[model samples]
Target: MKVAASMNRIDVNEVSKPEPDPVLVVERVSMKFNLGEQSVTAVDDVSFSVRPGEVFTVIGPSGCGKSTLFNIIGGLLGHYEGEVRIDGSKIAGSHESIGMVFQEESTFPWRNVIDNVAFPLELKGMGKSERLDRARHFIDMVGLSGFERHMPAQLSGGMRQRVAIARTLAYEPRILLMDEPFAALDEQTKLLLGEKVMEIQQRLKQTTLLITHNLSEAVQLSDRILIMTYRPGRVKRILDIKLDRPRTADVVGSEAFGRYVAEIWADLREEATRGMSDAESARR
Candidate 1:
């Protein structure tokens, strides 16, 4: 699909350093949901914008409205309080040009990998042959070249996630939204997949917003990390990650990287502890 090409064209030299353009802007966004006698506020007064070709991350403790924020931005939930704009256009109830990948196993058990990857294309009434051809390229892009015929049951957790990512990338949206896509995997798999995902993002330079709880992950994969406070989430701080590109485990061990991680960790530790206490109180 030619749309894929438009989303992937980024100058390598301009990737690690992106010029200013608001690809996705969230302004005075807040979310409140009612559950019978009580109301729960998930996000409160949150505002930020993802610059073009930048990996912007939102991190917070569990139930701090990070996922809720993502849902609003993806146009999956319209019941929220404020505005989410994609390329300056409001996306309150639209999913026309944004790609999304979630933490769950999104693969279809009944469909083969090729068909699963091509499902989105098929939904748009694309021809089978053309969809298959496009799916094949994305399949290889995510490093699942030989497993095109495999079903969901035949692949590992990492492989399944790869398929999900490939499926999202095939359509090539203006912004890619990911919600802890590697959290369910083992540490090794998560790290490896994170690296692969970062590489692909670097090459494509697509505007991305990733929601994560892992401090190191937020540091390693993002150009800037937006730390959120406890429930009724708000931006605590936006820490810039200045580590060199093609980030690896080696970078994590560097002195400068350690300092950067420590800075973000200092902000997150207290918020995370508060979140735990809140969960315990809710359980009681």
Candidate 2:
């Protein structure tokens, strides 16, 4: 696969001696769930690190515990076997340094755009005027400058997601965790929002970890993608993306982009088939 020369490619050696100071570290994390008298292993021995300002993505088949792993990292679900640390500190619960935007529309229907974006700041006890000022800046940054007064009901799906992003960034979290935030949107809208997200990441330089099933999205938005195996998720591979930055929708048409997408798809196809087979057998 075509790899970016300048990108910090994660090889066996690089994994042995990672960056001197990674912004986020997820080491040997494994999770299991108990249902009545039975138990289920959701994630199995997954480990990876995201560097400062890097957009790291995790992709895998359905039921591979992508969302579960994300929750563990966000400190929403605890009691996992391994450790998750941010800035060298273990994450015990919801951390101030981590912000999350989920797949569902999280915008408050009663609040206007500016109010929604400023909610995080409100929780932090910032004065209304100061919080609104910061909120407006992020709103403008996310291309929702004129929608500051619009309510969640007034905006489209993609627009509402933008509002969520602005709100999340207002708090200035060191790391951003997105759980398929654009999965519900149309392909065109998803691509547009992906570009917008990349622009925002470039501007803020915040370490971001996105869990997406879209191969194209992974290839387009990630500096490195961690592909997982079938159910009871594990790191299958971590592939480096070579495409140059400032990426837009047009990048999808490039030959290099296609190669990266194909490579990832090739890796995932087998795992997806296996996952489907397991599901079918369980149904029987």
Candidate 3:
């Protein structure tokens, strides 16, 4: 696991007070899936709130329904029970303020980098020139400045994911919902992109909710992490990360960082074991 060190870090001494308003409120949310005559609860009465400009992460075992909760928040799964509110108002369908970056590569193979990023703005009725101009800014932000015209096949996995992130940011959503966006990349690339994401979040102060299985990545990027139980997921615990700001890839070496990783691992190990046992019995 890569640890993060401080680089171009935000100055704590010059930090301004944050407003008290929460950007997202997920209240008593539950979700179930039906297959023929059988039904399974994926998430059970989960509740949490994400503060403005905060990077809040959810981590759990493979079948813990982390992705299910993310879909519910993004308004992609409307069959869910309970309320999901954004900016204090109930989310009826897909709200304009929410944006999602999935683990799967969502870049359009037919369009180049700039066009892919601008596609969202285009859908919003933005003019061609204006949308492309706006797309360039985000492309540059994700460090893909020279590759503006590169096709998705021409880029590496990491570069492709950057395009996806730039595309999401082009919409300028108030909250970013990232579901394991780095899970597909190699370790080195994953660490580099994770650092890039932290830098972007710090600079933009966009409220972000990330669902990840990587504990090290969770600790590096999150202000607080919500750990959930196995299938029929529930909030097991929410840990506040006290690490300093401007964390680079080197911070993973610190003793404090190790402790945080260890603590979360201890909690997750028990749940993972239970999930394994359940699967074994079901297979019999």
Candidate 4:
């Protein structure tokens, strides 16, 4: 079994922060799937941790099991090797402390923004009026105060994603797991939404584990990034992004930011090539 290092080396920028105990921890996690008369390993001996109030990102090539590891951490996949923990307790299934925002627009088409954001609260037996009030605060946090009455179908893709985020925030989870939450949007929209996510993250000091393919987005939003190897993904490197916090879209232009991006891309290039080759072979 393999485990990621407790201390990550800095890349590009050479600053360090004191290490705190992890809010989320994965120990020697490995997941496998069985096909008809065949078996495949998706994630192999992966280990990492997310500190409180920091954005910890996972990045890798297409077939690198980033999503597989993410689902495992989210408790969406209950059967896997090794163990996962949040706030000290081991997870067997979906735990209330962990929340997920998927790549898909997850807002219910039938529910309006307030109703959608309040759904989780309602599930907890909070009164309708009180839940709506709580929902409104999260909706406002995502900058959707005026769209409280709008249904998912009535909003743009980005707006619907915002609604999904607000809905997750309504429950006030201790840890947030986002799997390519802004993946479907165009570049400009992704950047803008990323800014909104950063704003909400800073405000709430939410401990987040984000899975993304966009290096620029990772550089802009992450405090540290864990790069994975191709197929049967394992930790290849962990790069501490020593950029100033409370970041925005404008930060992408800085020399430090560009260096981080370049450094990560260099690390990913060969692994991505191997992934592409595997993809072609599988298609044959």
**TM-scores for candidates 1 onward, in order:** 0.90, 0.94, 0.92, 0.93
Which lDDT value does model 1 have at 191?
A: 76
Residue 123, candidate 3: alpha-carbon lDDT: 93
TM-score of 4: 0.93
lDDT of predicted model 1: 0.83
| Residues 48-141, model 1: lDDT tens digits | 8788898999999898998998888887888777777776677757576789999889988888889889988988899989999999988998
lDDT of 4 at 61: 87
Question: What pairs collide in candidate 4?
Answer: none
TM-score result, candidate 2: 0.94
Residue 79 local lDDT, model 1: 76
lDDT of each: 0.83, 0.89, 0.88, 0.86
- Work out candidate 1's RMSD over C-alphas: 7.9
Best-fitting candidate, measured by TM-score? 2
Model 2 agreement with the true structure over 1-284: per-residue lDDT tens digits: 33434344456335534567998988888999998898989999888888899999999999999999989988899889988888887888899999999989999999999999999999999998999999999999999998999989989999999999899999899999999999989999999899999998998887899998899999889998998998789888788887898898789999889878878888899999999999899999
Model 3 pairs whose backbones collide: 3-249, 3-250, 3-251, 3-252, 4-248, 4-250, 4-251, 4-252, 5-248, 5-251
Choose the strongest candidate by lDDT: 2
